[model samples]
Target: MESWELGEWYGEFLDALNRHDLEAVRSLIDPGVRRAHLPRGGEAWIADLGEFFHAFPDWRWKRIQLVIEDDRIAAHLRGSGTHSGHYRDIAPTRRHVNVAEFAIYRVTNGRIAEFSGSSDAELRAQLA
Candidate 1:
């Protein structure tokens, strides 16, 4: 896809994600999308989000920037939400938090094929 088209595609996916629409999110991903750096499939990706969204009921992802290079899309984003549910072994703080993140996503055939991301150092300290 062209850079502009790919950006639009990601925008739509993010919109669906913000709305917490699982079906819409699924529509934008490949059936075999990789999770983390593992070989797991799209369901794993979806399940991971399920956990994240559960922890942050009002989770919001705002795209700060998007750069399309070849088949990869790099994104700079900010996320904020109230930690009101279980996250891993950490009990809910019920406290609002914000974090910045950067991610590189590979798209194949108009669907996300692979993704890797990192959050700001402050996120770790804040969560701790």
Candidate 2:
């Protein structure tokens, strides 16, 4: 896909996520999508994301920029939320956080086929 097309596609995917629409998210990702650091596929991703939203409730991601090349798109994003519930062993502190995140996604057949990125350490630090 052209860079602009990929950008629009990615924007729609992010819109689904920000809306917390798991069904839409599922439709946007391949069933066999590969996760670079996770053990399983798209289902695992959906579950993990659900847990994150449970913790933050109002978490939102804003796209800062995108770099597209061939079938891959690199995204620079800013995510922000209030800690209103449990996350792992951390209890809610009612603290709000905004952190930068970098992610790369590989698209295949117009859907996300692979993903690799993290904001774990930075997110943890801010929540602490």
Candidate 3:
């Protein structure tokens, strides 16, 4: 796909995530997508993503920017959610936090095949 198309697709994926539309999210992600940030990767990451939304059912993702190239898309996103559920290894603190995250996704056949990203430490501090 073209770079613009890839960027649009990534935007839609982010929309699905922000909306907590699991079915839409499933449609965008390849069943075997590899997620390098997770321990077991692939399905594990998918599961973790679902859990994240479960914990932060009201999570909102605001797009800061998106850069698309050949078959990759990088998204700079800012998100805010209430700590209503456990996230990662962090227990629920019932606090609200705004987080800034950057994600690079490798797209194949219009599906996200791989993803790697990091969250901003400053954002984490704000939450704390």
TM-score of each: 0.91, 0.95, 0.86
> Which prediction has more favorable lDDT, 1 or 3?
1
Model 1 Cα lDDT, one tens digit per residue, 24-125: 888888888875755477788788788888998999999999999878999999989988998777789888889988988999998898888884356546
lDDT of 1: 0.85
CA-lDDT, candidates in order: 0.85, 0.91, 0.80
Backbone clashes (count) for model 2: 0
> Best TM-score goes to which candidate?
2
Which scores higher on TM-score, 2 or 3? 2
lDDT of 1 at 110: 83
lDDT of 2 by residue, 1-128 (tens): 88899999999999999999988999888888888868567888888888889999999999998999999999999999999999878999899999999999999988889999985899889888
Clashing pairs in 3: none
* lDDT winner: 2
- For candidate 3, the lDDT comes to 0.80
Worst 10 residues of 3 by lDDT: 37-46
Better of 1 and 2 by lDDT: 2
lDDT (Cα) of model 2? 0.91
